[model samples]
Target: MHESKLIIAGGSGFLGQVLARYFKTLGWEVIVFTRSPQANRVAREVQWHGETVSQWTRELEGATAIVNLCGRTVDCRYTTKNREEIMDSRMKPTRTLGEAIARCKNPPSVWLNASTATIYRHTHGPAWNESGEIGATPEAKDEFSVEVARAWEETFNTTATAHTRKVALRTAMVLGDGPNSVFPVLLRLARLGLGGRMGSGRQFVSWIHEADFCRAIEHVIARAEFSGPVNIAAPNPLTNAEMMHLFRGLVGMPFGLPASEWMLEVGAFFLRTETELIIKSRRVVPGRLLASGFQFQFERMPDALRELRMRMTGDVKCTLPLPAI
Candidate 1:
């Protein structure tokens, strides 16, 4: 029997590496398409400048699935140059992949493109499903992010790929133990007694555990009914204050120093990142996945945080080696 091949574009990042390691353990031949191919990387690496068709296009033929996680990290300050790169990075790769898949003799059955949960308007009232309202709110400071997401999905929706089913993964913040992931940073802050609520602390944080994230992707890939925009977040979205309280408890910290909106803005400027990332209320939920009978291993925030904490402290052993980011 021939082995199934999985291609991940921009697979050197935190989420990409997680997916690569998980799929590899499931007996899939994982190939990472990256601009910087390293010999010591976790999976096989293929080089491709994201916007153009190259020799890497051949790998798309006869592949089981192609996951496009290609996008500039939104962790930096949103300058004019950074804004342009951020928008271009997402749209160009999506457009290029569509072209490649269209030309392939045997294109992958499914294409999962990365999108963001920040596309939804800021709301503390109710959780947002796939069909939720999408727009920017001045309070969230997510205008640029919403613009980027809208253009990115628009490009993917307009692209014509006759044989492949496409799914836009409108993912929230993914919690993992990787250095590049948010988990370690938050954990470190908790340990330092700084894991307090930021701004008003009422902003809802939508998140998913790394394990469930991988499982959710696999679930979507196997189910043909899943198409268009799908929310990849846990069902129980908690407030920023609530999440930080959990973190403080997990770390055995009695007190945490809270940062006001102005303090957050000042800190963000020094950190070279935007405050919108932390302040936005992303109350996204996986409606299609749940409606289709997909069960999440780590559904709630407390369970997910405890599991990650245990793994970090060596209380629980991981089955697979950590993938290099």
Candidate 2:
């Protein structure tokens, strides 16, 4: 008898792809929901329109959990149009999935949704907990990091299911391989002698490894005790400069010139990306995940980057101190 599997919405994304594969390796079947046309893969495919729930609701039959990673990338610049798309993209699938779970004859016991860490204020030197001061829009910036982050969480929390355990993952940047990889891209730039800190290099970057990220999801799914907002990030936090140094070390390049806040703003304006992502400091901690007994395989940033580099390029390099947490 095979162990039952879980359902993953947006399972084709970078993070979702890693997670779907991870769960498969653990001998659990995976049902992926996406708006894209069917692509051949290891997991079962369920067609979704992103506007209304489909008959794919049957996929939840006898499933172990449902992890919803569906949301527009917050990395993009926030224009009025982008804002609508972001909100709708996030809320639509959320409402659809929640409604589907609510209507399922046998819904998965766990429902984990994607959220953001920018939801917390990042006023350098200040620390935020699950209870500490949540973010208010910083007066200096026009970007809607706090607003979008708040609305994203609000949409998830209000849309509920009485039968299913809903877990919202207030996650930070998830670094890994293939597309959306922060390593090879940054390392490639580093190898090209372009690697350096963005903006002031003082902003805090909270992250989770690809391997451990999968485990954390599984931990939440199987634990049966964890619910509500959980911060999925590394215990060992680092600054933008620290991250740049690690990357430069990995790719054998001296850390190059740092991009000032103004430069990032100008560049992001052209690229339609958000500068607050790299400009505003976010010293976020994983207070809930740690206390919940979720052990991370690579809690430290340097180690995680090294392992990821090894996996991608098959190159062995200098070692890093593993995080005890």
Candidate 3:
């Protein structure tokens, strides 16, 4: 009998590596379709440009699951070229995977595509859930990012895949143990006494721990009832000020320097990133997951931060070894 297999497209980054290891521990044959072929002991690596359907598509046949985490990082300035690349990087691969899955004689049981919590409008009122309104309002200052997310989900949903269950993962900021990830950056800022509220500081910040994020994906795959866009975030969403305060407390920083809108603009400019990422209010909630009996290990912000802090400080025993790539 053939072994169970999982295909993670663009599984070379921080999240992907952790996911690859998680599935590998379950004794599944893990195949990663990435552009660059790197030496990895745990998973098999296949080379494919994300936009094209190549021989890598063969791996999709009879696969147990396929999680599409493809897309360029939105950690840069939103220049015209950057915007185009950002949109294209997500849309093309999603459509291409759909086509590949359509061609598969034995398609995977589920295809979990990555979306963002930022798809919802910037607001402080109600927490945006799976059924929440998508942000296309002219009032939204960062409508461009929301539009990109809208198009990304649309391409995945519209694709013809009869045999496969499709779920758009509307993910929030994932707090993971990686130097390049947002956690480390925020940790550095906290240590430097720069972990302060940006803009009005009333903006909401939603996030999930890396462990819960992986587990949630697995839960979705197992439960046939979960479909459509599911918000992959913690239940307890907090204001930017509250979040920064918690971070400062965890890192032993008594105070953080608050930044106004103009100050944030200058800082973003210096960092070569956009301020909207930090300033935009994203009060996202995982209503569907809770309704579907998905239990998160890290439900609250303080608990999640504590675990991450311990991991970063080498106080807790590491569960999974860091990926070779």
Q: For model 2, how does the per-residue alpha-carbon lDDT over 9-66 read when each residue is reduced to its tens digit?
A: 8887788888888888888888898877476875878878767877888887677888
Give the runs in model 2 whose Cα sits over 4 Å from its true position: 139-143, 319-325
- What lDDT tens digits, residue by residue, belong to model 1 across residues 288-318? 8899998999888878887898888866542
> Which sequence of candidate numbers ranks them by TM-score, best first?
1, 3, 2
Cand. 2 TM to true fold: 0.93
Question: Poorest 10 consecutive residues of model 3 by lDDT?
Answer: 316-325
Q: Taking the tens digit of each residue's C-alpha lDDT, what string does model 3 give over 1-325?
A: 8777889998888888888999888788999988897985457899889777888889899998999999998989999999999999999999999999999999999999999999988888998888787775444468889989989999999999999999999999999986547888887898898988878989889999999999998899889998898999999888888888877877778789999888988988999998878888889999999998889898887778888878768766423221111
**Candidate 3 clashes between residue pairs 3 or more apart in a chain or in different chains:** none
Q: Which sections of candidate 1 miss by over 4 Å?
A: 316-325
Worst 10 residues of 1 by lDDT: 316-325
TM-score of each: 0.96, 0.93, 0.94
TM-score for predicted model 3 compared with the true structure: 0.94
Off by over 4 Å in 3: 136-140, 316-325
lDDT of 1 at 223: 89
Give the 10-residue window scoring lowest on summed lDDT in candidate 2.
Answer: 316-325
Per lDDT, the best of the predicted structures is: 1
Clashes of 2: 1
